[model samples]
Target: MARARICKPCLWTALLGIGFLFIWYFKVLALGYYWLSTTVNAAQWEGSSLWLPGYQVAVEARPIEGLTRNTSGLTFNNETGTLFTVINRPPQIAELTTDGRLLRVIELEGARDPEGITYVQGDTYVISDEHSDSMYWVRIGPDTRHVSIAARSSLGIRIDSVHNSSFEGVSWDSEQNRLFVVKEKLPLRVLVIKGLDVFSESRGFNIDISEWKSSSAASLFMSDLSSLTLHEPTGHLLLLSDESALVVEYAPDGQPIGMLPLWRGFNGLQRKVPQPEGLAVGPDSALYVLSEPNLFYRFERIQKPAVAAN
Candidate 1:
C-alpha cells in the first residue's frame, strides 16, 4: 500500500516528461528555432553573402532514372562539369548531369554504408562510410567503371560514433585544402580535417582534425543533419536537415546567416522534398539537391530579398 501510493505519481510524471520531449523534438523546439534563428540572422545577413533566400526551386521532385532508392550525398565535379552522388544500398557512385538525368554508375567496392561523398580536385574524391566512420580516397576516371580503395588510402575516425547518426556529409575546401564532415544527430557535429594530402605518394600521414564549433551549432535547431555543401565563392557552409526540411547557411566565421527551406509552397517547390540527402552548388551557382529514393531538385536564384517563410 505504501509503494502503490508513489506508483501513480511516478507514472504521471513519467508520462508528462515523455510527452514534453516528443513535442520538443518533433515540433515546438524546431518551430521556435526556425523563427528565432532565421529572424536573428536575417537582421545580420549581408547582401554579399551566399544568401539562400534568393533561390527558388526550378525543378522539383524529378525522379532520377535507374535509381530505386538510397541516392545519398552529392558533390559537383568542376573538372567534368557533372554531379556525383552515392547509393549505399548497392554501393555505387553515380554521375549525373546538372539536371535530374543520370550519366553513369560507378560501382564502389568495399564501402560500408557510404553516405557522404565530395570531390577533391582532379578526378579524386572522398567517400565517408557512416557505419565505419571512415573516409576513403578514390579516383574516378572517364573509362573507370569501378573504384576499389587500398588500405593505405583510408582514414577512420571512431569517436563515440553511433550507427546511422555518423558521417552523413563531407565537403572539401579547395582554397584551404581542408575537408569538412557532418554527423547526422545525437549531438550533431561538424569536424574539419586539414593537412591530409590525399594525392601524396608518401604513405606517412600528416593530418589534423578539429571540431567546427559555432554558437548556432551549439544551439542547432535542426532535428537532424542530412547533408552539407560548401559554396567555394563565399566560403560559406550550407547544412541540410531532412527532418527539419531546411538548409541553414553559415558564414565563414561560423555565424548563422541565411536559410533555404525545402518545405512545400515555399521556395517555389510544388511538393516537399522527401528526405533530402544530397546538396551541391553548380558552376553557374545554381543549387542542386537530391532526396532519397531518387528525387532530384534544382533551385536557382530569384530576385527575392526576403526568406520564404512557411
Candidate 2:
C-alpha cells in the first residue's frame, strides 16, 4: 500500500491562519475589557436595585461670552450670594450671577488643573487639583480678589498618584462637618473626610478619610466625576459627569436616589449640554451647572398638581 501523500504548503498555511486567529481573538478581548472598565455607563449594567427620580431642566445650556472658555468646578457662595467657577487654563476663579453674567475674576497661583471647589464655611473654601492629588484650603474675603500661593495651603490627603484620576468634585456637609470628595474614576470612589482643620493657618493637621459605599445603590452612569453639589434640605448629593453628561443624586448613605440627564429630550432640554464640568445647588435649592466653553444650566423641581377637595 502506498503511503498517504501530504501537501506541506497547505498544512503550513492552515497553521499560520490558526495562529493569527488566536492572537486576534485575544486582542479584541483585551480592548473590550479596557473599554468596559473605563466607561461609567458600563458600570450601570452591573445590577443595582435602587430607584432614582429624575429632574426637570429649568434652563438648558446657554452660552456666556465674557468668561473663560474652560469652566471646571462650581460652588455657591451664600455669603456673596453668587456662583463661583474655576478655569483650568489660567487657573483662575470667576464669580457669576444667576443669569450667567460674569461678576469677578480671581487668578490662582501655584495650582495646576483646579477642577473642583466647595465652600466650606465663612470665607474658607476647598479646591481640588486634578493633575496633582492636592486639595487647597483657600480663604476669600471682601478685600480678597486673588489667591496667591502664599495664602493657599494643601490639605494633605496623601492619596497615591494616578494620572488624571485625581479629585474632581467636592461637597461640604456643614451639619456633619465632613467633606465629600469625588475621584474621577478607575473606581469612582467618594472620599468622606472628617477632622481636617480647614480654617487653620498651620499646615499640619490629621485627616480621617473613609470611602463612602452604599449596599443597594444605583450606579452613576458617568464617565468622570466633574463636580458635585450637596443639597442641604434633602440631604442628597448631585454628582456631575463630563463625558456621560449626567448628574446623579445620592442620599446621605451614598445611595443614588435621583438623577438628571444633561442630554437633550431626556430632561426637557432643547439642546444637549456639551461638557458639564461643574455643579452647585443654590440657596433656594436650585441646581446650577457649568459647562465647558462657557455654558450655564439651571434645573428646577416640578411641582405636582394640588388634590381636589373631597
Candidate 3:
C-alpha cells in the first residue's frame, strides 16, 4: 500500500511534465520560433537591402460589393483583362473588373466546393473542388448563366485523407501547359501536372503529375496555402498564406525569393488582410488579392522615393 501511494504520485508528476512539454513544443516553442523566423525573412526580402525589392500594396483592401458568399481562389483572365474568383457555398464564379467592380456571377451547379479557378485557354478554365479533390474543365461567357460538369472532363487526385484539407489552390502555366495544385496543409505540397488536355493512342489524356521538390523548402516559410498565382512576366510564383498573412514569392526553380507581409503596418493599410483566399497577377504586373467575407486588395510595384544625395 505504501509503495502504491509513492508510484501514484510519481506517475501523476510524469504525466504533468509530459503535458507541459507538449504544450511548450506546439504552442510556445514551435509557433514562437517560426513566427520569429518568418518576420526576419520577410524583413530581408522587403527591406531595400535585398536585390529584388518586395512588392507593397498600392491601394487599401477594398470591400467587394455584390459578392455575398465566401470567396476562394482567384485567376486573372488575360483575354478579358479581368479576374475570376470562386464561391464555395454554391460553387459559382464571379467576374470582376480591375477596380473590383462585380461584372457578373455565373452559377455552376455541379462544381462541388470549388476552391480554385485558373484560365487554361480561350474561354476554357480549370476549376478545383476541394471536397471532391477533382478538377473540371468548363467555359463561360457574357451571357452564360449556368454551368454543369456533364460536358466537362474531371480528373480527381486524392492528396489528403482529410476532406477539408484537400486541393485548395491551383495555378495554370499557359505557356508550358502545366497546372500547379496546392494541398491546403499537412505537409503542404505543390503538385505540378502536365499534359492536362493531351491524349495518347493507348492512354486518354495522359496527364503526368510531379511535385515541385523545392516547395518543401519554401513551405517552411508559410503556415498554409490559401491561393497561388504565376506572374507570366517574371515566371515567378506568388503563394498566399492566410494563417501567416503573407504572400511568398517563389522563383521558377521553386526557391523562395521574396515575401510580402499582409499586415497593416507592412502594407499601406489601416487594417490587416484577414483570411486571404485568392491571388492573381494582371498582365500589367499588378497583383490582385481576395479575402474571405468579400474583400479585394491590389498591389503594384512603385518607385521607391530617391534618397537625398548624401
User: Over 4 Å off in model 3, which ranges?
Assistant: 1-53, 198-203, 215-219, 304-310
Order the candidate numbers by TM-score, best to worst: 1, 3, 2
- What does each candidate score in C-alpha RMSD? 4.0, 9.3, 6.0
TM-score per candidate, chains pooled = 0.89, 0.77, 0.81
Q: Which residue pairs show collisions in model 1?
A: none
Ranking by lDDT: 1, 3, 2
Candidate 2's C-alpha runs over 4 A off are: 1-54, 158-160, 304-310
Model 3, span 171-268: residue lDDT tens:
98877888989888876777899987722222257779998755444244566788887765456677788887877666576656566778787756
RMSD of 3: 6.0
Writing each residue's lDDT as its tens digit, candidate 1 over 1-310 gives 4664468888999999998688566555655665577676664674556578778889889899888899899999888888999999999999999888989999998987999999988888999999789988998988889888656387888866886888889999988889999989876888899988888655566889899876554446677888998887777889999988988788788877777889888889887888999999887778899999799999987653333210
Give each model's clash number.
0, 0, 0
